[model samples]
Each structure stands twice: as C-alpha cells, then as structure tokens.
Target: MHRSAPRLSRILACAAVPVMLVVAGCSSDSGDKKEPDSSESSASASASKKAEPTVEPAKFAALPDPCKSIAKKTVTSLVPSAKSKSGTAATSSDTSYRAGCSWNGLDDNGVKGSQYRWLDVGFTRFDSDQSLGSGAERARQDFDKQVAKAKVAEGAKKIAEAPVSGIGEQATKITYDLSKTKEDFKYATIVARTENVVVTLTYNGAGYAGAKTPSATDILKGAEKAAKEAVAAVAGTESDKPSGSTAPSEKATDKEDSPKSSDKDSSDGKSTNRKTSANKSSVKKTS
Candidate 1:
C-alpha cells in the first residue's frame, strides 16, 4: 500500500505537467494582444502608399481684368461716342472666375443721321477640379455651351456660324440680324477658348433717322478683331505673375498638357492668345 502511494503521487505529478503547459500557452496568447493592432496599422499604411494623383492640375491660376482687356484705341473705333470710354464693368460675385464689360453710344450727324453702336465682352475662367476635370477641359465644355447659346439668340434672323482661326485655341463667329428699339441691328458674336478661359463678345449697331445700315460683313470683322484682343489679354496675365511664382502642381499639369497642346497648335506653331495686339473694347446696350 505504501508503494501504491508513491506511484499514485507520480501519476498526479504527470497530470499537473499538462495543466501547467496549458496555463503557459494561455499567458503567451494574452500577452500578444497587440498583434491585431499591428496588422491594422500595416493595412492603413499600404492604403496610403497606393494613393496617387488622379487628375492633372489646372494651368492658369487667375484671370485677367475684363475692363482693361482691350486697348483704348480699339474701343474708340468700335464706339465713336461711348457713354463711358472706360466701359461699364459687369457685376459678378467672383471677378476672378467671371467678368464682363460693355459700351454704347450714338454718333450723331445732323444731316446724315445718327449711327448707333453697341459692344459687349465677357470672360469666364475655370479651375482644375477632380470631379469636373482639368481647367482646359472645363473651359472647352463651357465654350461649346456658349456657342450653342449664341446660335439661338432671341429675335435673331439670318443666323450664321463659322469656325474662325488666329484668335484663340478654338473660336467660332456667329452673325445675325435683330430688330430692336425700332432699328435693324447687325449682330456678331465671337465665342473663343484660350487655355482655360472663355471669351464671349457681341458687337451690334444700327442706323437711325434713315441712315444706311452697317454691313453685316463689317460687324463680323469688328467682332473678330475685338475677340482676338480679349484672348491676348488672357494670355498676357500669365507672364504678369512673378517669375517662378507658379505652383509646382500647375507646372506639372502644364508639362502633361504641352504635348497635346502642341499637337493641336502645331499648324501655327504659336499660342493664339499670345498673338494679341494693342486694342480696346466696349459694352453692350441691351435696349
């Protein structure tokens, strides 16, 4: 019986070895509670590493001043007796993105009768938006919209549209006749896109007191001249910025767009907006 006690004790000790081993394993597992947290952090880091630029940045940072877009001499030629030679500026919540100017006058000749002229110019600028796309693309979309708007001008007759060159990236001229204020007015609108800016200009004139009506051809020519000057003004704004002031992202975008821009402009080998001459602009008379 005494020998049986020793054997039984040995059996109990053998059983305790497994229980101790189980306790040790549980302790090890509890001490490693941070393992899941480490894995989660690695997952977040991996996601961050995968993030990259999805779209090109905008090219132009700001828009040119609308009032000064044209030269004084050009304004005088377009409007001989402008109510405000400086032009009336359009109201805008944000001038940086949208602006306009207009001028109107009557050149009265006692016997020959009075010549009434009205001119208006407007500008809109776009920015690079991830949801919307690059600035130039946005501008192009707006350009199309403006062209469509001009095609259906109210009370317009003999409407015509034709693509024009030597003005901007791409431009279209729309001409028509409208009777307003008891006078038949000739209207010409030039809708143009320059990089990321959109220029819309309307020129119209009438004959008063049985005066000879202005030629539709003359209206179109005047509209084209003013549109070119406005486009040039937009281009001049870029160089006005301090040297090296351009944002790095904008520079990157410019680099990306250069090849495509060159492809479109290779025919002229120059930027259309940059071809501006010194000229002036005026405002429109709604009446």
Candidate 2:
C-alpha cells in the first residue's frame, strides 16, 4: 500500500507541470497581440495632433533692376526746399535730373536724342498748386485739365492690375489740341508705374494736313521697362518709399498733416516753378 501511494503522487505532479506550461504560452500570445494594437492606436493619435503646413508672406526678392532692362534711362534726386503761407509747402531743392541714354526715334527725321531732364519728387506732399500756371485761377484750370485728361482713376486701375505695388496714383494718357500755329500739333502722354514711382512718356508732333507724326508706343514701352527697373533698384534697398524717411499714407492724410508754413515756403518753391514751366510749354513733356 505504501509503494502504490508514492507512484500515484509522482504521476499527478508530472501532469500538473504540463498544464501550467500550456496556460503560460496562451497568456504570452494574448499579450503580444494586444500590445501591437495599442501601439498602432498611439501612433495614429500622435499623427492626428500634428500641425498643418503654413506659408509666409510674399517678399520682393532680388529682382533684376528695371532700369537695366530699359535703355536710355535717367534718375533724378528730389529734396525739400521751401515753406508756404498756409503751412510748410514741400518743394524740391538741390534737386538733380540725371540724363539717361538717348532714344533714337524710329522715324528717320524724328529727333535723335537720349532721354533728358528727369525730375524726381523725393517725397510726395499735398500741394493745392499742382496746376501748371502762375496765377491761381490759371493754375486751378491747368490742374483740373491735367487731372481730368490723365484719367487718374482708369490709370490707377490698370496699375493696380500690374505686378508692381499698387499704392499710388498714376497718369497714363493726355491729349491736347493746339491748332493756332501753322505747325500745330497734337500731343499725347502715357505713364507706367512700379511701386510708388511714375514714369511718363510723351509724344508730340505737328498734325499738319500732309505731315507725319511720331507714334509714342516705342517710347512708352521703353519708359515702362525703365520704371520697372528703377523700382527694382529701389526695392533692393531697405526702403520702398521715395522719401526714405517718410511713411506711406492716403492723400487725405497728407492734407490733414500738412507741414508748417516755413517748411512749405522752403520746399514748394521749386515745385511751383516746375508747375509754371509745364503750363507755359504746350508741348506736353514728362519727367
């Protein structure tokens, strides 16, 4: 009886060990499947929390100089000079107009000369005397005519569509009928803009019954190229405003923040002179 009892106990122990091993294997397999699923879920959540990509503002990178693209280009410097009675009227003093390369007219007899007399109004300030005359009434009339003929609104719209900065007013076309002289002529003016600067092209020729007149298309294209290049040169620098020190504001803002009388007198004298000259010269020329 004692020998039989020992053998039975040994058999029971061997059976128990096999059952325990099977249970342990099943548990390990379950843990491995659950862990893989959990890892996948965590990775998906992390990807969901990631931010979307963003874009920065469009900066004017290093573009080729617009002046370089055009031939016969000129640059001028404008400075403030005088003050006026109402307040300081800004004027151009110590201003210089650097002559550019000459434009040979397409026509054989047309004037063969490089562009000359470029005027640069350093800072744009409001002036009631923007008209081209000595007398107030005459000045007013000239100003009205200029503003009306230039079609400022239309030109500004076109400029707005252009690739350049659409910040300022620009004039594109002008026509005048001067039939008093035997060699009476019709004049036209066109302008293009880049950023805050305006480049104007003028065409003037006798409109006699059997005479030939020069077309302004070539000159206009050249001016546009030069204007673009000038803008590029200016943009390459730190500042875009012509008056490096001044900030941009609406035209109305300029009227409200008018300069002092003394300043106006000093700065506006030269502008007034130019306006007077423009009025006297019926042949519409641009600077």
Candidate 3:
C-alpha cells in the first residue's frame, strides 16, 4: 500500500504542473489590453488624410488701358467742292496748298467718279542733304524711290496733287486715279510738318466705276487730323519742344511707321483687360 501511494503522488504532481502552466497563461492574457483593431487604425489614418486641407491656384490682375495716354484735339479739316470735269483741281490757302482729282470712266457707267485729294504743308523744303534736318525730305525721297521702283508714277502723281494746309506753314494737295494703270487701286499721300515733327499720311483704295467712285477725301482728312493730333500730343507746338527737350524718341518714330491697329483686340502688344486666374481668386476672396 505504501509503494502504491508513492507512485500515485508522483502522477498527481505531474498533472498539477500542466494545469498551473495553463492558469498562468490565462491570467497573463486577461491582464493584457488587446491591440487596437487593424480596421479601426486604418480608418483613423484614412480620416486624417481626408481632413488635410486643399490648396487653390492664384489669379492675376487685369491690364491697364493703353490709349488712355492720348489726348483730344481738333485734328481734322474738310473742304468740299463741286464735281469737276477735269481730273484735277488746286487750292492755295494761307497755310496750305491743296489739290484734287476725279475720274468718271473707270468702269461701265459714268456715275462712278473716284476722287483723290491731298495736302502739302510747305513749312519746310524737301532737301536732298540729310544734314539740313530734313527728316521729312529724307522720308519723302525714300518713299518716292520706293514708289518709282514699284512703277507707281500715276499713284505718285495722285499723291502729289492732294490738298494740304497747316498752321504757320504752306500746305499742298494732289489727287489722281490710282487705277490708271492695270492695277486695281490707287493711293494718295500727304506729307506735312507740324511745329515739332514731320508727318505723312497715305490713303489707298480701289478705283471707281462710272461716276460712283470710292471717295478718299474724307479718309485723307481723317488721317491728316489724326497725324496732327499725334504730333501735337508728343511734340507740342511748332516752337514748343517736347518735355524732354530732345528730339522725339525712337518709339515715336516706330509708332508713326508701324501699321495702325484695325481693332481694339488686334493684339499688337497693347494692354488687355483680361483677368488671370490669380485675379479671379482675389476677386473671390474680396467677395
């Protein structure tokens, strides 16, 4: 009986070892907090990312008006006359020499009459020498050479005959049929000198058919007026020098030679009122 008791004691001790180990594991598991659920952690990360702020692009301001610098002036003059049979007429005012021409038989009907008019302000002579401060003369010579090379004698003659008048100077005018040659149109050029600068205005148009011709008299008048205003705006009066006391800058010369903008949006590098994205953003912020 004693031997059986000893063996039974040994077996009971072995069984209690495994049970204790199990109880220890259960207690340790119960004391530890569960790690945050992977799904919850992922959701929190996603929410944090979603809460981040978004940035928007900026807008730009609109450009200023370009023509605001130009001033208003009485820049044009018009003289009307009865229709003449001859292709030419002339007038001599105190300050201007004016001439004009009309053609009736360019086309089938006699109703179309293409009239040409020109003005020459003889304030200064056309000098061949460049040292005489004859910039106008130089330009005229260059233009004449170009026209002659182009074989536009009739066109030149017409320009030569347009009516011209100016302040404190003698002006001349000439008019002619540009379609006298096989070409489809004609041009009239006016060269005048203001108090401070020289100006040349040219008008080109198609020929007349019958008595109803494209009248360029008004156009020339407008051009002359515009030129006078432009000169006065920049150079002031004949005796008054520009504010800088120097000759008109190259920019003025460029403006004179450059092609006139036909429309407001013609895009010759003029400032536009277009608002950029930054400008729009600024407007929105203000609102």
Candidate 4:
C-alpha cells in the first residue's frame, strides 16, 4: 500500500508542471501581441502629420528710386515751374519695397491768373507669400483696390474712368474735378501694374486768380506719360540690397500725407503752397 501511494503523488506532480508551463506560455504570447513596437509607433505618428502648402514665386525682385523714375524733361513738362525740378521725394521707411516723388508749382503769369500744377508718382512692391499668394497676384489685388479708390475720391465731381493701353501690363485713368482752396482743380490719376509692382501717378492743375483751369485732356495725357516712365523704372531696380533703405534725399510730398498749398517760392527746399497742385488726394494709399 505505501509504494502505490508514492507512485500516485509522483504522477500528480508531473501533471501540475505541464499546467504551469502552459499558463506561463499563454501570458507571454498575449503581452507580445498587445504591446506596440517602437518602429511601428514612429511610422504611425509620421503618417498622421500634416504637410505645408506650396506657393508661387515672385517676379520683380526690387523697386526703383522714385525720385529718379521719371525723366527730367518729362517732370519739367508735367509740372512746368516745380518747387524742385528733381521732385520732392516721399518719405519711405523701406525704399526697396516702397517709394514715391511729387512736384507742385504755380506757373505765375504777370497778369494772367497763375496756373497751378501738381504731379506725384508712387511705387509699391509685393513679395511672394506662402499665405498671401504670389507677388504678382498680390500686386494685382492692390491695383484693383487703387482703381476703386480713385473712382471714389472725396469731394470729386465729373468723375470719369477709362482704360489706358501701352503704359504697363494694365492701366486705368481716372479723371475728376475737385474744389479746394476756392479753385476748381482738374485731376487725372493713372493706376498701372507691371508684374509684382504697382505704379500710381497723379497729375492735377487749377487756375488761380482767374487763370484758366487745365483741360482734363491735357492732365490725362501728362498722367499717362509719367505713369509709363514710372512703370518702366520698376524694371530697373536692384533687389539684392539691404531692406529699409530710407528716402533721405526726398522732401515732403502730398501722398506722404497732405499738402499745405502755397503759391510762391523759387526752387527752395520748403514745400510751398501752389497755384498748381501735385498731390492732395486723401484717399491715396502710401503703403
């Protein structure tokens, strides 16, 4: 009887050993299948990440000096007795991207009422932006905005809008009458675009002390000519220079802000009021 009991106990112990091994093997397999692997986790994270969007490249790389944009003879023809034949430069924090110049003078005739004339030209450049689109596209947007602004000038009368060709990629002429300084002023503004740059040219005149008001035809013609030159100047800039080149050589201009119109002064640096006007459109944008 004692020998049989020992045999039974040995059998039980062998069976228990198999049970323990099977349970341990099942637990190890479950863990291996459930836990994530490092390589697989990295790949999953990468797949879920978002990619950045692409944008088109810009065309024009730089802007021209606004004062030197128009030819000397052209300036003289536009504003005959200009305060500065060299043009009064508009103040710019960044001359590379933005610049402007203006001329205003009263061509005083001994007895005839003085002829008032004012001419101003401004340039703006847009860079390619990932969020804002391409430079040319941005310039086009601003060009539209400028045309719209010119169409709605304050205190303007006899408003006229026309398409002008042969100036730039595209151009528009806006002519109107404005009453300021107790004078009837004829105004012509040309809004033009050449790739990534926008050129805005304004030419206006008034007859003071009974001088004849400048014909809108003549003002529009002069505006178109200056605009053509200003647009061409944009193609001549050097884009690689440092940013924020200021216009220290330029004097005060109306688009810099507003003009304090005065009638007389001969080639002096100070901006005297004018019998003729260069720029005074409060609606004009400098940026």
Candidate 5:
C-alpha cells in the first residue's frame, strides 16, 4: 500500500510540472506581443504630435543697416546740414529682425526762417514660420499697419494717401501737414514691402523762424525714391527698378494696349484698301 501511494504522488507532480511550463510559455508570448504593440503605438503618437514643415523659404535672410538703407544722395537731399550724416540708429535687441535710424537738421538762415528737416528709416524682417505664414505675407500685413499708423500721427492735418508704383513689390506714399513750434510742417511717409522686409520712411520738414515750409510734392518724390533704395537693400539687388510702373499688371496692360493699337492700325489699313477699291471701280466705270 505504501509503494502504491509514492507512485501516485510522483505521477501527480509530473502532470503539475507540464501545466506550469505551458502557463509560463503563454504568459511570455502575450507579454512580448503587448510590448511590441505598445512601443509601436507610442512611436506613432509622438510622430503625430510633430509640427508641420514650412511651406516656403524666407525671402530676406537678414536686414540691412537702417542708417545705410537709403542712398547718401537721398539722405543729403532730405536732410541738408544733418547733425549726423551717419544717422542715429534706434536701440533694438534684435537688429537682424528690426532696426531704425533717423537724421535731423536745422539749416539756419539769418532773418529768413531756418529750414528744419527730419528723416527716419525703419526696417522689419520676417522669417517663414510653419504656424504663422510666409515671410512676405507677414511683411505685407505689417506694411499696411505702418501706413495706417502714419496717417494717424498726432497733430497731422490734410492727410493724403496714394499708391506708388515702381518702387518695390508694393508701396504707398502718405502726406500730411502738422503744426509744431508755431510753424507749419509738411510730412511724407513711405511704407513699402519688398519680399520679407517692410520699410517705413518718413521725411518731414518745416521752415522755422520765418522760413517757407517744404513742398509736399518734393517730399513725396524724395520719400518714394528713398523707399525704393531701402527695398533694394533688403533684396540685395540693384536699386534701379521703376516704382510700381513696371509691375506685372502694368506689363500686362502694356501687352494688351500693344495688341489694341495694332488692331486699330490694321482696321485703318483695311478701310484705306476699301477706299482704293472704290476709286478703282469708279475709274473703271468711267473708262
């Protein structure tokens, strides 16, 4: 009876060992499959959270020196006898993105009023951002803001706004009159956008101590020319392009006009030929 009991106990132990092995194998296989799935899911989620790429490259890599953005000739004309020919640059933390400079002068004329002039140039550069917008588009928005800001300057009167062509990708000329120091001042503000850069130039002057105030047309032309120079500087190109005049739309108009003019000439030629035919028929009939 004791030997039979020992054999039965051994048989039970062997059956239990196979069951444990099967359970262990199942648990290990399940864990391995779950771990791989979890890893894959985590990787996919991280990828999904990644930011999208930018649509286009930034137009202007860097900004030009605000003091040097305008041509020397322009600066001389706008601000004769300027206190600082080099211009006083505005303090900014990031000059690469934004900068400004200004010049002011008082040309004294005894008994005749002195000529007082102020010229300022500012530049803003935008970089392409995945979430924001293309640099050029961002600049365009800011350009409009600059123009609006110029129009609302304190003490400004008789404000005028005009779209200027041939200076940059787009440009506006704003003129206004202001009274300061009991003298009338004339101002011309040019806000232009070229690629990713926005440029704002202000040319203002007054005749002081009995001098005659500067003319608005002169200021407008000077501001536009200086704005063109600034835009060219931002593009790192030659400042030789006509303001707004040579724009794509203008070129298209020229092309359309050329065809229209040619058609008119052709019609005139056909009319002349018909007249000649009529003359020939009359001569033939008379003969």
Candidate 6:
C-alpha cells in the first residue's frame, strides 16, 4: 500500500507539471505582443521607399487669352471688314494651357474682284512631365507637328519653308498656295517656339470676281509681322517691341558689311557726301 501511494503521488506531480507549463505559455502569449508577418512588413517598407520627387519646374506657367493674343489693330489690318471685330476665341476647357483666335473677312471692290482674308493665331504652353520630357522639349515636338501640318495642308501647292531669325528662340515661315472657291489663295504659316510656349500664326487671302490674287511675298511678310507680334504678346511686351528680336548674326553681318561697303564706295572715287547718300538709300531700301 505504501509503494502504490508513492507511485500515485509521482503520477499526480507529472500531470501538474504539464498543466503549469500550459498556463505559463498562455500567460506569456497574453502579455507579449506578436510581431508582424515578414512579407507584410517588407511590403510596407517597400511602399514607403517608392515615393519619388517631381521633375524640374516648367518654364511657362500659363497662357494668355486667345482673343486678346493679337492687338485689335493687327486683327483689323490682317482681316479688314471682319465679320466679328472682337475676334473669335477657340473652345477650350483649359485656356491657361491652350488658346486660339481666328478672323475672316471679305473686302468688296466695285469694278475689280473682291479680296477675302483669313487669319488665326494659336498659343500653347507645356508643363514639365517627369515621365515624358521638359516643357521646352515637348513644345519643340508640337512645333514640328504644326509645321508638318501646314506643309501638308490639303491641296497646297508651291510649298516653301524658310528659317526666320530675330523672331524667337526658333522660328520658321512656310508658304503655299491653294485654290478654293474658284480663287487662288496664298497662305503663310509661321511656327515659333519660345521657352515652353509655341506660337502658330496663319494668314491666308484670296481674290474673287477677277481680282488679283495676293502675292506670296506679301502674304509671308504679313504673316511674319503678325507672328512677331504674337511672340511679343507671349512675352507680355508691346506688339512692336524690339527687345530680344535682334539676332547676333544679323548684327555681325551688318558690322562686317558696313566697313566693306564704305571701302568700296571710297575705292570707286566717290565723295564722302555721295557715299553718305548711298548709305541713306541702302538704309531706306532695307527699311
């Protein structure tokens, strides 16, 4: 009976050992917080690291109003007797990014044929895009597209392209002729890119009722003048502003040619007064 009692006591002690261990484990679990899963923790850390900064700031922050881009005098000069004197603004949800204006008119002549004219100016501004490129680069791409579009105008003939200096960062003049309404129409399109802004000005004219069609030279000159005004407007300057329009190349050419012209006049045995007169005539012609 004593040995049996001892064995029973030992068995009870063994059972109590397992129970105490279980209780201790439960207590530790309740008191200590659990660690997060490794995969979830890694994902959270990666998400925090993926944050990136923005690229360079855009050059131009906003665009000017379309209808007011060109001066009223300029509009009147280009499209006399326009149907709408105030100019028509293009439809856009965001005028600060893009805007345009257009005008069309017909000038009546009693005996000769009547003249018809159309003009439109557009301004586009770009903001820097991190995934794409800088604002200026984006504007350059758009400028090329505008030039191409002008060159491929439906039924355009005698297309000519010339690089124009002293206008903007870069500029090009494109001229072509198209027949519409049984009248010969001359077109001049100027595409210019300055900073992050792109300016496109188009001037077209036609003659009706046997009127003489406008010459390409005249049309191109008008377009260039208007384009210069548009560029100036983008710079928030006067239409006839001359600042930043003088090309170094042109200045250098003038400098190099002035002495040569004077020497030639002197070598020809011309008097100083005659040379001065010739210079005046040349200046007048250039102007």
The C-alpha stretches of model 5 lying farther than 4 A from their native spots are 1-7, 49-51, 55-57, 107-114, 127-141, 209-211, 237-287
Per-prediction backbone clash count: 8, 30, 47, 10, 9, 0
Find the candidate with the highest lDDT and give its number: 1
Residue-level lDDT of model 2, residues 22-140, one tens digit each, is 99999999999999999999999888867533233212222222223222213211101112112222233411111112122212223442221122112211212223322223323
Candidate 5 per-residue C-alpha lDDT over 72-164 given as tens digits, one digit per residue, 9 for 90 to 100: 667878888899987899998988788889999999988986999898888887888878889988888999899899999998999999998
Give the runs in model 2 whose Cα sits over 4 Å from its true position. Answer: 1-70, 73-91, 94-146, 149-171, 175-181, 184-186, 191-201, 206-211, 216-287
- In order of lDDT, best first, we have 1, 4, 5, 6, 3, 2
Q: What is the TM-score of each candidate against the true structure?
A: 0.75, 0.26, 0.30, 0.69, 0.68, 0.64
Residues 1-287 of candidate 3: C-alpha lDDT, one tens digit per residue: 87899899999999999999999999878656344466678889999989965432111011101121112122112212213222222232311112122222222334555433332221222222324444344434544443343344533444445335662132333344565444444445455443323344444445343333455665555545644543343332223333223232223222333456334345533444344656788999999
Give me the runs in candidate 6 sitting further than 4 Å from their true place: 1-54, 237-287
Model 5 has how many clashing residue pairs? 9
**Per-residue lDDT for 1-287 in model 4, tens only?**
98899999999999999999999999999888666676678778777664555567777676776877787778888888999988888998977688888999999997887998999998888998988998989999999999999999999999988899998899999999999999999999999999888999999999999888889899888888888878777755534444433332222222222233322233233454332233543335442
Best by TM-score: 1
lDDT of each: 0.83, 0.37, 0.39, 0.81, 0.81, 0.80
- Model 5 TM-score is 0.68
Comparing 1 and 5 on TM-score, the stronger one:
1
27-91, model 1: which lDDT tens digit per residue?
99987977888999999998987784556766666666666677666788989999998889999
Considering summed lDDT, which 10 consecutive residues are worst modelled in model 1?
A: 247-256
Residue 182's lDDT in candidate 4: 97
Please estimate how well model 2 matches the true structure, expressed as its whole-model Cα lDDT: 0.37
